[model samples]
Target: MLTLRDYDNSDIEALLALANNKLVSRFLVYTFPYPYTRADAEWWISAGVKAEGDVTKVIEYNGQFAGSVGIARKTGWRDHLAEIGYWLGEPYWGNGIATQAVQQMTDYAFSDLKLQKLYALILAPNTVSMRVVEKCEYELEGVLKREVFKDGQYYDVHRFAKVLKI
Candidate 1:
């Protein structure tokens, strides 16, 4: 079963290992330096445990530290909306982990938090992550052409969202 809990300091090693992998970093906004270090995990875990209520955690499969799924509430004009972001360990890909995790997270976002909209800006070539969003019932809003510059080149994003009527 998938569980969304707060980050525990003990998970530092596993979290860093997952976050710094080449395959995992490919779709993320920032790429971590090679040779994922223990200190990296320590810093991440320390902050994650204290991230207030805006961020959330998920343990994949059986203790794989699977990945994190977060909702950053937009301020100002987009205050009613939240931006969703998530990633999984490379070795844990091909499973329905991400789909299940995001679905569970969004359900709470809509009902518990009373959020109007939740969105994801998927990297252009990340088909697997896109498919996960699709399976979870998030519709493709549009393509944000040249929206992000990552790994030295600009990439287009297929914006996806699931809106909950208030």
Candidate 2:
């Protein structure tokens, strides 16, 4: 069974362990530091985990911490939209975990958060993540060509979004 919950002090070690892997960080944005350190985890917990309007959750698998997912509330011109992002440990990959977590979070974002729409930006090479969003009924809105520079190269970002029924 998988569950999503708030971050706590006890989650530090598990967070560090799962987040420190290069494979897990490869498709993630630059903000998710590759060499994931204790300081990084601490700062994330304090600053990123529980933002005022956003929903950030730890993915707990069978009672153990495995990954994280969240819906970031947008502002200014995009107040009705929320950006979603998630990552799981390498060990938990390909077991339907990402799909399940994404579905659950999407529901929360729409129903509990009362957001109008949710979006996810996927780097071109990460087809698995693209599929993850697709599985949750998000539609491909467009592609931003060479929008992000990472690993000494530029990559296209595929924008996917889903809107609430009403």
Highest TM-score: give the candidate number. Answer: 2
- Residues 16-79, candidate 1: write the lDDT tens digits: 7787778777777663445568877786667643554476675556755788887878777787
Compared with the true structure, the alpha-carbon lDDT of candidate 2 equals: 0.92
- The positional error of residue 18 in candidate 2, measured at the CA in angstroms, is 0.8
CA RMSD, predictions in order:
2.0, 1.0
Error of 1 at 163 (Å): 0.2
List the pairs of residues colliding in candidate 1: none
Q: On a 0 to 100 scale, what is the lDDT of residue 89 in model 2?
A: 92
TM-score, structure 1 vs. true:
0.90
**In model 2, what are the clashing residue pairs, if there are any?**
none
**Candidate 2: where are CA atoms >4 Å away?**
none
Model 1: lDDT of residue 112: 85
Residue runs of model 1 more than 4 Å from their true location after superposition: 31-35, 48-53
